[model samples]
Target: MSTHALGSAKLVLAQNVVHIDPAPAVFEAMKEGWARQQSARFLRAASITPRLRLIERFGEFTGQYPWQWTPAEGEAFIAHLRGGAKPIQMSTARTYEVTIGLFIEYLMDSRYGWTEVCGERFGEGPQAVFHEGNSVLHTIEYEGDPRRRPLDYDEVQALFDAADARPAKIRGQGRKGVLAALRDAAVLKTIYAYGTRRTESSRVDLVDFRRNRKAPRFGNYGSLMVRFGKASKGAPAKRRTVLTVPEMDWVVGVLQEWLSEIRPHFAPGRHPALWVTERVGRLSPRSINEAFVNARQAAGLDEDLDLHCLRHSYITHLTEFGYPARFVQEQVGHSHASTTAIYMGVSNEYRNKLLEASMKARLGEDWE
Candidate 1:
């Protein structure tokens, strides 16, 4: 029969293949085969390992090998996941179902000969256990937590104010967190000003800053190369340059003060990271998140607001400021204008101004 290097048929014939517990041998081979197949497609280990673990979890829950699996077991396992104290989100449940479906499809493909191998050893062959009827439907494009919306203009300023006050507040209480607090304040303002994701905020280097010839006053802080922009699945991080706009140009001073004065206290020698921790050259995404939480609590903003809301706020404010949709999309590095539009939560006042401007164009300036 047809066989590939990591195919079940080829693996079963190996000298080092498991000799006892033939069922377990075939099962392990199937997983290894699937992992190798995914590797060939250029997926990283971080992207592939969770699928293997989920398959193992499913196998354990069903108490059956691939050849012995049925739709009932797959449905039952998903149902079990939806129950218990730690029930998963619908998005997570859908992902699990999809992973199971992919794993089953891989095993049953004739070229791999897994079906033939399983039939010879276990008297059965793998079959599709998941289908449209049992799978979770993902109708919502934005399935993120509903609470994570954009901060209002005032809330954004208040958050910045709180982060700024943290250094003095800690120093007043006689602590050594003054420098770290200042760094975090700068980091938070930068995130809102640039509309960056958490990792993008932490991953920037000092050299990423660039000057704008047209806006020479900003002086080497006019824009930044976001080297760690969000990526497509299995792809490298995308890069984009976010320009300094007039509205949020205050971020220029914040960054200038941070790089020159406060950050040196951290003694980050030879470290290129824009945001650094005491022990590590680069700050972590989690620490960025914690900074947002502490600032939000200090500001007494809503508890539901998280770090991502800064990006949301940036998108919203840019829309209210009359930036073209396409320009905003490029600034934020969204591949689609539709994705950019979704993040924009323009104010009703802006809508009224648009209506008035349209009327004035047709009805004349004296019409009002």
Candidate 2:
């Protein structure tokens, strides 16, 4: 059995170790305890794997029962992490913190007699000691930034035009290449227009298109609900957004055609995931990134542009069009209004307008 350790905590794996079973008690406990405690859907998804591995590694490292470690031992572990072995990315390191905190809380509750070797926050207890011990360690500092960006109307149109005009492979060796390019370009458009994350966009099935079948009228509206495996347990509610008519039309026309015709020819799968690779699996985030990179090069656009940038661009577009920040936040499923405000900054046109107004006010009617 494979196992690994982080700091004082250890993960133990056993041959045929049925770790998480669907027992009623286990299911109910996890529902009320582990999953319910986590706020973000994504965070819950990440906790399960690391904790299971931790259990496996414990036995492997010490050749003893899994739950054995002193507070000092735990602190030493943190130092080890900070030192070199696990120089994890900030995003990934945060998951480790969340997992450890939840595991400790579970142990303390007495619902399960899981032993506790340490108290206080993981970062403060063992992790801090290690951090302080290492003078050369680089601390992570948060510079607040918003998460979504979408391209402007003109830029998106230009990119589409560029993709359409990409030189054919020696003038007709294969239309498959041309069609694939067209399909990917449309995929890019759908993601930006719909404000979907890459995973959500990738797993989107052909059935998702039928959600538009009964299109909503003036007094009626339709929602596109994205469902997936929840990190925590229970009925996973859909993260849904309503679509405007124009948005619906673009998705229905361009995106639907790719699914109906092109995607099946290139990539086939059990579920009709909207995007696919030549290999027949749903496109991964890496694939989406590579596609974006190639598209940018072909379009002669700035190299800095990527998939998520389109999300930010969308927020900016709405802000400039005079939509209220609150409305924009809701449209993009932003939990915090401030998060939306960060990406959708005051546009240059708006800033200049403010300056002009200030000048006019200062100089009376003399300043034009």
Name the top lDDT candidate.
1
Error of 2 at 241 (Å): 2.8
Error of 1 at 99 (Å): 1.3
**What's each prediction's TM-score?**
0.93, 0.60
Lowest-sum lDDT 10-residue window in model 1: 1-10
Where model 1 places Cα greater than 4 Å from the true spot, the runs are 1-18, 362-368
Q: After superposing candidate 2, which stretches have Cα over 4 Å from the reference? A: 1-47, 54-91, 116-162, 165-176, 206-237, 245-253, 256-286, 297-305, 354-368
What is the C-alpha lDDT profile of model 1 across 1-368, one tens digit per residue?
A: 54455544575446555577788877887888898888877788988999999999999999999899999998999899899999888888888989989999988888788888778777889888889888888787877677878998889889989998998999999988787899899999999999999989888999999998988888999998999899887788899999999998899899988888988878888888888887756988999999999999999999998999899899989989989888899999999987887787788888999999999999999868
Total residue pair clashes for candidate 1: 0
Q: What is the Cα-based lDDT of residue 9 in candidate 2?
A: 23
Best TM-score goes to which candidate?
1
Per-candidate local distance difference test: 0.88, 0.54
